[model samples]
Target: MSFLEKPRVLFYLLLFLIFGVYLSTVSRTVSFGDAGDLITAAFEMGVPHPPGYPLHTILGKLFTALIPIGEIAFRVNLVSSFFGLLTILLIYGIIYKLTKSPLAAFLGGSFLAFSTRNYFLLFCFVYGLALTNHLTIVFLAPAFLFLIIVTIRPSLKRSDLQREAEPKLQAEAKEGRTFPGSLKTFFQELFRIIPPKIIGLGLILFFVGLLPYLYLIPAASHNPLVNWDNPKTWYNAQELSGLKRILTRADYGTGRWTSTTASVIPSGRPAVYQLLFFSEMTFYQFAGLGVVLLLLGIIVLAKKRNWIDLTFLLSVFLIPSAGFMIYTNLSYTDSAALSALERFLIMPYLGAAIFIGWGIKSAADFLKEKLPQFDYRYFAILIFFPIIFHYANVDQSKNYLFYDYGRLMFDSTREVVIKKDDKAVAQPTKA
Candidate 1:
């Protein structure tokens, strides 16, 4: 078999290639936005902003302590690169599983790895670093669901089963079976289709994932320097309320759907503007060719009657894009807020990249039929387009703006003093 047929080899090759690119561009010091705060929080085992990312804090602490290569901030930045790479690999794996075309997977994965937004802020200390950007990570949910359903019920065609059972159900009804009996039979079939153990295991693992949130309580109780919302009290009259506020992001005024007072979306702008902005961002991510492939991929899936995979891609893409746009209602004019909003598009772009892979597979299959002499593997060269186009813009190896600014701020502040609400002042100290 050709090397393209060996997915394991291709997987490692992709990993190596992307790792080199990421390492070359990763920030050597603290980045903008929450980088300084997150690095400090992780280093001191403290908390950052609202929803105090306990899992990221814990993991960042481990990365900072274990990786002795760079400054403390650089180690934390590396954490983002690590997860960004994993996210790319997951997209590659998902595409390969869907298309069974290694070339297609490579192109899709590389497209995402080289995208400008991903490299600049994604692999940096901003939202994409340390999985604090839940929007990007949430896209994995549909991918996981798709894999689980495909693996567990690959041969269990729901339509065929329904058709086969319908006649039996009618016969049973004619024979005077009661409504309750039919309902019981229906549940039995449902349980048979999805075993109880699998459901129980899924629920158990979900709750286990919640275990990390408990870390916030103790971390806050220590009165860490970066603690937000101070969710330390758990047993008093305010039991868990503070923690609940942090977790629910009450400080940011999230969770309400129609909260006009809390919405950041400008008043004159309609909800449809969010959808338009998302489309514009989509076009920016992949450019013309990539977007074409994405559309073609959707068409190919629909033509092939592949509802499951199609739905999976659509869910991941639309939910984070259109769904979030409508939900968050963030204003488009605010550059800072918009910049933050753009990071959330990483997951949607992942979905689009997978579709691009499917489109490539479809195109290659057509080409093979039309021209037998043509080698489809040459299509993999397309991966270099983004790499070449984005290299100059995305490279962050020498980017030290954030690092220098942080140092300057610290050095400029001589004899710093702290005063509490009670007017208690700590002794001044020289910088």
Candidate 2:
């Protein structure tokens, strides 16, 4: 169907277009953090530092060559924006599926995908792939798992009980208390209720999604401008790919905590410290009211028995926010890295934003029923709030920091090299 036929489709397009334009305007030139290495690798068709981002590099190379707009960096930046938009689209689809209200879904999805802000995935394909575009994707696993369990747990238990009681029921068949169905029919019914087939398919798709890692092998062999820990051989490739890194994550001196380490109170700090920290991040992402609305949304979903969506959002929220906080043992000494971890909290922010949308919808529905004459369209104005909040916080359209920063770095390095060269020239005769 044409987009106009579906309000959700139109709203998705509108959100994507607006965000795409904004991201393009703020697109960096030289690079930001790992972005510089990523751009260079992509431009030269080389591998990036450690477990190279094969998919990002390959796709970036194609965009740099073919996009026919702006400089190489700008083109790569556009690729980021493009994917950013796609992520927004995905968020909208997910929210719409839950809320079944176009307006609510739009606001919620926009808040998560664009408003809160956010990654590249292929080094060590599992982690890299998971983190390639956005590390928040990892939150999906917990969310999906929660949804699966919540949706099927009761059914599974019921099926098990029925199976166990089947013999008794069959024995009583002579007394006319027969089993509900024949053995064949019972097996068929049990199969229908079982979630393994669907879960198995999901697992297959998840692995298939990692196929982009295959590109790394070929890209590594070519040896481009910036190949870190060059993965020319299979052994080197695996090493660079982060297989060891994942296993030896503890060796990196990173204070990563997991569910197992949940008991060890870091620095003798109480769990309340983590809760407050989580609260602060959530408050920052969505104001105090938004957090309340998120809780309210959970209540609303529970009331409606929306187990699937509730579990999904809980997964997204808990995995990244609570899960990370439990496992990632950050210290007060490193305010910088801890601040960066705040960025990872975007998953919970996303989950909260979604519930905020639902909360808005539920409130509006209730109010409209109470006051039948009141125009519910007034609630539409709240949509502009998220848009305005996002634009105000994120707008860097006129910032030329990337350019100035790159030039400064280049000049400083050149001067150092020149000084070293002069010192060598003066001393070389004696040698």
Candidate 3:
């Protein structure tokens, strides 16, 4: 077998290649948006804005201390790069596991890594980790649940059937003279189906995951430089209101919905226009080819009667894209609002990438059967189509516009203060 046939080898190859890409393109210093504030919060171990991303802040602090690289801002940016790489690897692993094809996984993972949007696609991963954008990550819950159910369904069914048979066996034993081992056999099957050890380990890990949130309490208590909504303050004698405020995003009025409950398009627009706006955004994702592949993938799954996989993929896509669109109720003409909405598309775009992989595999299989001598792996070159189109748009290497602008403002302010001090000294203390 060729080296590429080994999934482990291919996984490492992807890791190195994508890491290089990320390192080249990652922001050197603070970029726009919450990056400046986030870097300060990470440096000071303080809480950021609403829904204080305790986990992100904690991880960022570790990166900032440990990296010893360029500026502290760059180290914090590396946290985003690291999580983005992990997200890409997860996509690769999921696709490869489902398709059993390295080519498909490569295509799926690369499509997502290189897809162009307002910000890099991985901004969702970064924002989801460090900022208030939780819905992008939250949308994956349904897909994860579906996967868990599908994995254990067969064993669960067998367990249920065995339990039903136990009553009949007991009834038969009551009628008969003997059947001594039925109870022992039933208890053994119960343990086999749902092992206590596994359940205990799962519960332990779940709680461990929640441990990151505890960082908020102590960090907030210090009341560091960039603390937003000091979560250490008490609401009553018993409860910490500031902590509750940060967690619930009470200051932002998070739970309140607007009157305009329509599709992803602006509420005032016609349905046709709204759909056209939505469709245009979708079309540009992978260009026309990606849409075709997405449709083909759906068709392939439907034809194979793979309802579980189909539902999982569709839920991952729709819940983040359509669900968020409705939840946000954003305007098409509002550039800032639309840009914010665009970052949420990463999760859905990931789902589309997987579908594109399936489509690629299906097409490659058809071509191989017709021309037995042809190397279908060459079709992997199609991954570059996205890279070529999106490279110019997403490339951030040497793009220090935000960083330079910030520095220039800081320097100008310092110069002005220095000149004023010099002028005062020149006046001889007003004598």
lDDT per model vs. reference: 0.75, 0.59, 0.72
Better of 2 and 3 by lDDT: 3
List the candidate numbers ranked by lDDT, top first: 1, 3, 2
Comparing candidate 1 with candidate 3, which one achieves the higher TM-score?
A: 1
Candidate 1 lDDT tens digits, 225-301: 77776777642344333676777766566654323443376576657788888778777777567888899999999
Global lDDT for candidate 1?
A: 0.75
Give lDDT tens digits, candidate 3, residues 371-401. 9999987876776787788777776656677
Q: To one decimal, what is the Cα RMSD in angstroms of model 2 from the true structure?
A: 8.0
Q: Tell me, by TM-score, which candidate is best.
A: 1
Query: Poorest 10 consecutive residues of model 3 by lDDT?
Result: 422-431
Question: lDDT, candidate 1, residue 18?
Answer: 90
Where model 2 places Cα greater than 4 Å from the true spot, the runs are 1-13, 119-142, 150-204, 236-266, 287-289, 305-308, 412-431
